[model samples]
Target: MEIPTELSSYIRVLKLASTPSWEEFSQVAKIAGAGILLVGMIGFLIFAIMSFIPGA
Candidate 1:
């Protein structure tokens, strides 16, 4: 697309979007953190199991 068109589209999006409330941001942050921790725990569990195997 042309630069002018792209710039206009970006401006339109910015005009339509609003900043998230503090509570909304906090809730999303908590959910994202929980997901990261859960993935880390699963990876660690897999590593632990592999280390215990005979030839893994």
Candidate 2:
């Protein structure tokens, strides 16, 4: 079986859309980044509390 030229072009575009892009990142970057930051902060806080233990 063979794919048509137009079908191939549509597949190519579909493939590109399936990948992340800077414009899409720009829209959600802050939310994603903040979640990461929140996680890091919680991790560091846990680490700091652990370090405060006498023998940890």
Candidate 3:
């Protein structure tokens, strides 16, 4: 795409977007944190199981 078109598109997006409220931000943060924790726990569990196996 051309530079002018790309810039206009970015400007349009910026005009349409608004800052999230505290409640919305907090909810997203909580969900993202939970996801991270869940993935970490799953990885740890896999590592632990592998360590106990005879040959992994």
lDDT of 2 by residue, 1-56 (tens): 45698899988999887666888878799889999999999999999999999888
Worst 10 residues of 1 by lDDT: 1-10
Cα misplacement distance, residue 31 of candidate 3 (Å): 0.3
lDDT by residue for model 1 (1-56), tens: 69999999999999999999999999999999999999999999999999999898
Model 3 misplaced stretches (Cα beyond 4 Å) = none
Candidate 2: 10-residue stretch with minimal lDDT: 18-27
lDDT of 2 at 12: 92
TM-score of 2: 0.54
Alpha-carbon RMSD to native, per candidate? 0.7, 5.6, 0.8
For all candidates, what are the clash counts? 0, 0, 0
* Predicted candidate 3 versus true structure: per-residue lDDT over 4-45, tens digit per residue: 999999999999999999999999999999999999999999
Better of 1 and 3 by TM-score: 1
Give the Å error, residue 49, model 1. Answer: 0.3
Q: In candidate 2, how many clashes are counted?
A: 0
Measured against the true structure, the TM-scores of the candidates, in listed sequence, are 0.94, 0.54, 0.93
